[model samples]
Target: MMKLDGVVAFSMTVEAGSISQAAQRLGLAKSVVSERLAELERTLGTTLIQRTTRKLSLTASGETFLPRARRILREAQEATAELAARSGKLSGPLRISAPVGFGVLHLGPALGRFLRDYPEIDLSLELDDSFVDAASGGFDAVLRHGAVGDGRLIARRLAHSRRLLVASPAYLERHGHPGTPGALEQHRALLYSNRTSDWRFTAPGQGWSVIRPRAALRVNNGLIMRDAAIEGLGIALLPSFFIHQALAAGTLVAIDLGVQAEGAELFLTYPKDHGAAAKIRAFGDSLRRSFGSPPYWERVEPAPRAAPI
Candidate 1:
């Protein structure tokens, strides 16, 4: 019988494109992964991988064996999931990937509750702002906000969040609030560096207008940009989830430019075949329950206050 561990290591290495990355994903030492792959090759009586100082390539046998090896892994997982579902018990490791801000602000608490509910399940959550490929990264699921264009993955809408233009009361007091989108050019903007285009908005009467704010400071994190705006740095266009508390507390006020900002769709995405997996289903259901129909953040409407002097 083929060793399942060796097969998994070989498959993960091929998917990740390097032994180091596979090792990191598998939570194993590089030497251990190498030894497993070598053992697998020895068992098969063939050279599976051609490794050199600079690069690693698959031998002819490795290329031919990869598809079957992947099938074996997939079948084993499906079978395990089926049995686990029948027993109504969730076990095994569930790996998840999520954006840093959302993970920190929302998923952290939600996952805590989930773990308490399913003690048998081992969960590993990776928080990163960079985009992660769910299939290749070996993640069971990924929590993301915005469009998921990958056809291979299945996306379930968790909730919706809108972007709001906001600044600290002190900042707005010092810098006059803009009455319109066009007026945003005059203000010092604290921009989120990850956004590809300019800020855009729409109103009932007005169509759509885009403004590229003169970035006084650009940061990759939404929380940092929101805090900087609160520190009286500059106006920031940020997601409501990040600013809702400040808005409610009157520390940050929304700039009513008479236009509605674009809303973002939060999704819990996973491999289509893995949808029936106990852990993925349980987590997805938990997220849907936690966020609810309108989401908890959206329920806290920002109080209206007079424009700062």
Candidate 2:
């Protein structure tokens, strides 16, 4: 019989794409993970994964075995969770993934409180700004802002996210604030993620408008972009949670675009096929409660607007 630990090691390594990453996710040493993978292969009498310097790929046997391995792990986890549920107590390892900025600014404190309430639950959190598939990534839940693009995941709405264009007082002071969408083209655009060379906004009477922003710097991280905007490098479009403190302190000023900027609803998503694990339900409840009925970020004072044209 294959040891569950060995199976877990192999499956986790495949999900994470590397032994080092698997070790990080599993909270085990890299050497320990490697040894377990080697031991598992020895027991199974096959080389499951093709190892290389740049990447790891699954061999024919490994590819065939991956689905079964995941199912086994899920079944074991569900069995354990079922018993914990029967005891009327939530306990077990709950792995989660979240975007970097919102996770740190908002979700981190909320999760801290949840952990306080449930001391027995061990939590592993991965903070990433890039796209992650909760099922493939081995995460029980993912806290996401914007669209939950995958249909395979069940998403529960947590709160609304508001985004807007903003810039430091110093930058606006030197360059002059943009009074219209057309005016934005005159200033430097601090592009984030896929924004690239253009920003699309809804114009009141004219409908959709595209502003081609001159970019001197582009970054994939929201926190870095927020900081860059605050440093007077350029105007940026950012979610409220990311720039609320900066806005309050008058370090960054919101530009009144006369229409909503780009944003989407916040969601806590889990694999639809996995059902509602006790931990996922528990965390989702905590998120909805802590985020408030209107969410804290929405309470920020609105920017002064020039009357409708």
Candidate 3:
């Protein structure tokens, strides 16, 4: 097989117009360049250049080979330039995985701004409730609710997500609000299958306690459970961010504001030891800046009075 090294050496030598010039450009010894050129000539069984005291000139055979050599060098130069640009610039496809509801409500708009700022970057986003294998799935990064278990994957806390027990005014009117956690059992509740049946609470000057409510419907999606609660289906336990708009609009009310689950968090994760992968870094930084400081996700959404229909 013809080695790219020899071809590269020949190309550089021709462009540089001397073995010494090619060596200087390539950071190789002049002797090494001369040997590679000789080997290339021997391999092709043709004398490509004639050496003179003043300057090196291409022979008849060299004239034909020169163009092809320059073409190869040009292609190689382009490839190198492309790779360097990719490494430094926030350009190319970045695959990201996130939870369905969060992606649609929060991340979607954020990504829109990110795309605007980095028009060169192409995004491949997948939102689902199921666990994702970032490495195996060729994902550049992932945003997950709660702390991750895998120590191999790297994670950065994007926000502090707090879970809340909430219900609609209409449902509370029909069922009445439970003043205590134990009182929840008397009321209908919409629960997620992924969450525990027991709900936690804390009152003024009281320690945390857990209570299991009587479920009206068990669901898998937080958005659906939230929607059901908004439409007066039942009380729902959900992350504060999911129902922020609803809560602000007076469509949903936080039932137990003084309690939370143990060790709940939200994270943006990616593979470790990835140094200066431009697209990933840009996206990660953009996320960090977007949810900067205490994190917008952790902010409590106030209940706005219902507007007249």
Candidate 4:
């Protein structure tokens, strides 16, 4: 009989485009993964992959066998999911990836509740701002904000947010608030390094406007940017979810440019096949419930403004 481990190892290596990456995803040693692939080739009496110093390519036989191998893996996963569903018990490892700020601010509580509800499910959560390929990363799901561009993954909308321009009252009092997007070019901007410094806005009469602000400080983390903005460093265009607390507390004030900023759609993304996994489904549902329509973080009322003299 063909060894299932060997078949899986071969398939994962092909998908990952490198043996090291495959080994990382499989939680196995690189040598073990290579051995499994070699064992599978010997059992089949055929060389499936061509290995070279630069890259690995599939042999003609491998090209033909790749789809079959994937199908086998899919069917095996579905079989396990079916059994788990029938038994009505979610027991397995569920790996997830999320943005660092969101994971810290919101996912922690949601996960606490999820863990209590499903004690048998094992959870692994990775937080980072870098883009993660769900398949290669071996993540069961990824919580993402903004557009879901990958056609290979299925996305479920969790909540909505907006990116707005904000500055501390002290900063605005010192530097003066810009009445239009064009004026932002003169001000120091605290920017998220991963994103463009150019900010965009739209309004009923204003149509659309974009401005490239001078970056006084650029960092990968949103929390750092938020802190800088609070310290009166400069203006920042940040996700509403990230600054909601500060905004509500009157530490940060929203600048109305007579136009609305872009809306951010939050999503929980996963492979289509993973939709059948009980753990994935349960977790997804819990997130939907926790975030609700407006999301819990957004539930606070706007801070009361001082009366005009």
Residue-level lDDT tens digits of model 3 in 2-38: 5568888888878898889999999999999889888
Alpha-carbon runs more than 4 Å astray in model 1: 1-88, 205-207, 307-309
Ranking of predictions according to TM-score:
4, 1, 2, 3
Poorest stretch of ten by lDDT in candidate 2: 300-309
Residues 200-231 of candidate 1: C-alpha lDDT, one tens digit per residue: 88888877878887989988888898889889
Q: Which stretches of candidate 2 lie over 4 Å from their true place?
A: 1-88, 194-197, 203-206, 302-309
- Candidates' C-alpha lDDT: 0.85, 0.83, 0.76, 0.85
Candidate 4's C-alpha lDDT? 0.85
Q: Which candidate should be chosen as best, given TM-score against the real structure?
A: 4
TM per candidate comes to 0.73, 0.69, 0.65, 0.74
The clash count for each model shown is 0, 0, 0, 0
lDDT of each residue in 1-309, candidate 4, tens digit only: 688899899999998999999999999999999999999999988999999988999999999989888888888878877677556567778899999988888888789888877788889999989988865577888888878888888888888888889888888888887877788899999998887767888878656777889999999888999999999999999888899999899888888777787787888888876644567777887887877778866676557654211
Candidate 1 lDDT score relative to the true structure: 0.85
* C-alpha root-mean-square deviation, each candidate: 7.7, 9.3, 12.5, 7.2
Query: Candidate 2, 226: how far from true, in Å?
Result: 0.9
**Considering only N, C-alpha and C atoms within 3 Å, which residue pairs clash in candidate 2?**
none
- Report the alpha-carbon TM-score of model 4 versus the true structure: 0.74
Per-residue lDDT for 185 in model 1?
Answer: 96
Better of 2 and 4 by TM-score: 4
